[model samples]
Target: MVSTTFEDLNNSKKKLITDALLNEFSHHTLSTAQVSRIVKESGIARGAFYKYFDNLTDAYNYLYHFALQDIHQTITTDYHKKFQPDDYVDQVREFTEKSTNSRYFELVKMHLLFNEAHFSTPVSNHLIIENEFYWATQVLIHDAIKQLMLDPSSKELILQKLANVLHRLAKEDD
Candidate 1:
């Protein structure tokens, strides 16, 4: 968690630090990121960096959640409602397109490629409900995203496979 001191910063100052963290994480894995670089880029003192975050991992978590919130807002599907395989595929496709073009592209790519498994807080498995089908679909969706990050040209094929599996799961549940 970030310090209250960081939360107290004005929006513009927060954005500056956010941008710097994004740039640093986009270019380097968490293992290689440098506080000095972030401080220099954000125009904050090294001491202020520590004051704002407990450590580099805290800063990275902050940036990760920040990007996630922005991306989630762009997705229109309500997963809490009925799970529509086609609709989910469409949503994933839209997300892939937007994320590829967004400012956080490299950061997301870097995370999927290298840093994701190393996160201090492992990715959540919590779902809206506790059905095994829902859990499987969620895992598959995440895998599809990772696959898209690795080979963007395979998107149509990947989405098709994902849709096929999801439809099969839905049918089985009936």
Candidate 2:
């Protein structure tokens, strides 16, 4: 989350900073990114950047959450609703199809595979095990999609294999 100073910025100013951050992170992974570059590109002073976020990780998390918000809006997932394996697969498939169309999809996948320190830790108050199961499945889907991207020729075969594996996994819940 951005600091109150950032949230309070006028819409145009906010949009400028957001666009600059998105472009910066889109082109470079966290380990290779530089705040000085972002500040120079955004035409803002280094102090302004710090005023909005604690550090690069904080800025990255804010942008990452922004991407997730877009994804959730594109595909509705009710956390409170009962879980069904088939429905879960369908939702993942839908997200996979739609998400690939976005410009930030590549960056999002890179963040997933490369950023080990940022995984969400589920709260323990309710359905903690269920949350872990879903999180694991999400990770599997990300890895499968990334693999498919790397070998476009094997996409159909790999997708079929994944479906078969998921089918077997779903049956275990019976």
Best by TM-score: 1
lDDT digits (tens) for residues 57-151 of candidate 2:
88988887787677667576676565455665566666655556676676666675676355554532233456555555555665676675445
The lowest-lDDT stretch of 10 consecutive residues in candidate 2 is: 119-128
TM of each candidate vs. truth = 0.90, 0.79
lDDT of each: 0.88, 0.71
Q: How well does candidate 2 score on lDDT at residue 147?
A: 70
What is candidate 1's lDDT per residue for 74-129, written digit by digit as tens? Answer: 68845578878998898888888878878988998999899988853433545545
lDDT of 2 at 16: 85
lDDT of 2 at 145: 69
Q: Which stretch of 10 consecutive residues in model 1 shows the poorest summed lDDT?
A: 120-129
